[model samples]
Target: MYILIRYAALSGKRTATLFPDTPVAVACSLLFKFVLNVFYGTIVVENEHYIPKNGEPVIVCSNHVNSLTDALLLVTSVSSKKRNFLRLTAKDSQFGRKTFSSWLIENAGTLPIQRRKEHGDQADNSTTMDKLLTALSEGDAICLFPEGMSRFHPTMAPLKTGVARIVSDVLTRNRDNPEFAVTLLTCSLTYVHRWSFRSDVLVSFNPPLKLTVKDTPSLISTPDKPVDFEAIKSLTTFMHAQLSSNTIDSPSWDLVRVAKTAARIYVPLGTRMRLGDWVRVVARFVEGLAKPVEGTGAGTGGEGVAIERQGMKRTAYQDQLNALGLKDDRIRQSITLSRIKILWRLFLRICQTCLFLAIAAPGLFLWVPVFATTTYKSEQLKRSGPVWDTHDEVAQTKLVYGLASGIFVWLTAIILTTPIFGLGLFFTIWFVPAWMWLTLRWTEDLIAAFRAAVALYRLLWVSKADLKRLRETREDLHGRVMNVATEVLGLPKDPEAEFLVVEGEEGDDQPSRWAKHQRGRTRGGWDSALRYFSIRRRRKRDWNETLRWFDATEFPKE
Candidate 1:
């Protein structure tokens, strides 16, 4: 029944603004993602808005990360205007028929393949290659992570030759037209606080690189042969320049990691409004130019009032899309109020879920000690990059702090109830659920924080004075949360540790999970990012200000 609603909402006509395969996929993904990005531990930030507007068939390649969460980020990065023709290549380990992950894959229109029993030698590379070629030939931009498996590595390990072959095959298939070049859009996603609430992800979008007929075929690696070292080397080098080129001159290891180690993160967009407002106005103009004319013809005996009602709806919708920054009438017909109705339901469902959890948090607080040993993973994820890469001490400290917070909560409860009686019954009924609910409640808060942050930044120029006050309020709120954290942990807050660098040091450098080919390499530029993005200039100023407040970078003296 639910599936029927989703399919009902999906547009099937060839003339629909969205591609036939895309609408349901887009709605489901975005609906699921709105929850995941908020409640689950994922953050989507600094999206590149330009590449999607340039709209053409292309391949998005990146290093593999755990879970299908990457797909959600990719979906949100795209503008709704150009989502019809995108698809993904997913492997079978997680995408088999009965699995939850597989359901998502199928629903998202992913093409799945079975991988080798052994890690490497016997893998059938041919079927995978064929699937991608077919998808691309159909004008669908294919998205795949070149590194097939997800494992912890400091650098991008040898890429399966499959991706290179796909590019080679596509260019070979379309050798005649210069415009038919296979475009490779490299995206670099770096986490400022990986997996944490309100974490920041910087997505660096490089200009698309075209591997044309003139480029040598020798760069394609062969499966049966020793993986072509030169070809793999060149590919990584090119990507390193595209993805990590900004790393070249940075002084601190942190900046360098942010710039290079994440060189191969992938981005796939369903619809991208990354176009500048002026460009959007221009694209809207172009779309208006291309939008189809819709003239309603009456059925021979239908009621005139019924037809009049439909006409009013059409008129109202035309006005709404124009207000949402869409200029084309084609877009108006595509996003019916029925589509927005689903979005409203998704929004309401998420709100109800958090509300229910907020009512249950107190009960969960009482069971913390039990969940602590069982939850064994509260701090283990810190080992991965962008934060506690080498911070075992920090990880251990987090566990201890968590335990301490439990103790503080108990003690506070005891103090509050001394005159009345034992607090356990009250707590078992109250704060346990409160704690449980807060985690989910915090999810909404964090997501709202991010959304509010983006919306506020979007209007910074027009609302400069209000924006200044808001940032001050944000800092004050952060300070209150920190205080609450300290009190819950029963720790006497130290004024000194406020400024200490507890996360990383020079001696603890571990290999970045994305760098390929050991020899040090680098590239440079922001002229393109600047010219295309007004936000880039504003972001640069904010980045510089952020650096000053977090002044750990020991810039070299001139």
Candidate 2:
């Protein structure tokens, strides 16, 4: 079964004449599911309703963070009922590849985009533009990374003029067709651990910006007009604002880390935050910490403390976190548990991990070669060039090489055992991928559990004194952050208060209306009931309000 599945995936035979209209859509969906479920863990999508399902052509624009992974996630996760034909724009160089990757690209229906850096001054995108225009005219969906390239940048790179130009050209040509409306949809992809296997990914789709001929009267005055450069520039700025609002656009990677750590620490106990909510909190931190403006005079003895200065202080706090080799969650756990209890928990966790390891031993043994091959190949790719050096690129290279190596391992195993086992090899081959999956699952859990346990053990034993000091430091830092948030971001006095509205999750507790409702109306047993109660007691804040500070239009003057 595994071999057949692999064969089907690797086959070069074409199916549908149009890209996504055939089995390719199903293949893409399955591929996405495999990646998100097997390669990664806990995929969350927010504002999925924003994905237009009315069959109107839409251009999906996203920040390029995870190389090809970004494109895959955007195309797969954001779907329209009327149109699942999502074509992606890739660099022209990638389209010419004759390898397995090129086959995958062909099946995916990707349009080749020209980049000046690669093609130099002679780069031509006329053919690609024609195809894109035709697709959009037929109400197809197109995904493009406005950044042109993918990297682990602290914030989005300056968006290319291509997105704006595409929008302009599409709207200008279709101005007379009142039925033709091209919408620009912004998708924000946030990976909790970019390069790590089984890391979490949050895909947040912002509300679509509908561009009708009527909406852009200035740019689409005449349908016969050539590409409007001024319209493209204006629209690009607008695109920047839309993307910035939907993404965590920190000024630097260090500041991004600082913001994330601050958010992790700031989230109140018993409150669960998905990556979407967490990013909004982080965005608030970035807005507060990125700029060096006068702090509210109330915090620092008549003189105001600039948020940028506060950010500097927090940098040291983040450094402390790194030095202690503990996450804010671990610190919080330590603060609540006695040292003896911590030791007990650590011992149990270790024993639990050992049990998992024992169960997963056979799978791990079989897959070790595949993993090693992928690692070696990915490392080589990292040393290849600057383009392949980013964490996401390495991950993507691993995905490619890992798939290739796994097939090689399987074929070799079958060849070796077929003579002795004969027909039995077919039955046993299924166990290969199955066990490998089990091992991968075990490994993911093992790493997370063991890391926390080790960190806890170290806090209780190795760096015993640092625990208390770190706790105090974290508390002090948390308090200072709250003050700055309240003063600088104009947050409420109790910003972390229950009933605070946030991104993804919103709405305050309905104390007045709860008495009018009955639990019998709900389904899904105790779990659903508990979830209902949890949400009822939960406080949410409109994270959009705080995140607006990072909007490109509102960027503070230096």
lDDT tens readout by residue for model 2, 355-462: 766776777767787678867877786667664245557667666666667778777777777787758589558766666766765655555556656777667764
TM-scores for every candidate against the unseen true structure: 0.43, 0.79
Model 1 backbone overlap count: 28
Which prediction has the highest TM-score against the true structure? 2
Worst 10 residues of 1 by lDDT: 261-270
Task: Report the C-alpha displacement of residue 235, candidate 2, in angstroms.
Answer: 1.9
**Global fold similarity of model 1 (TM-score):** 0.43
**Candidate 1 at residue 142, lDDT?**
60
In model 2, how many backbone clashes occur?
7
Candidate 1 lDDT, tens digit per residue, 1-558?
001001112333222222244565666655554433432222323224435432355777654432344444555554445433445655655455674434655666655455765436656657656756765555556666666554322234455665666776776566555555567777654433323323333444556776665564454333543334576567656765554432122333333322211110101110111211111122222222223334435663224333432332223322232233222211212234343453554466456546545654545555466346423544454434434232322322332344345546656665666656565566554664345445444433434333323322233232435434444533443343233223322222442232111222211222222221111111114423443222111112111112111212122122
What is the overall TM-score of model 2 with all chains considered together? 0.79
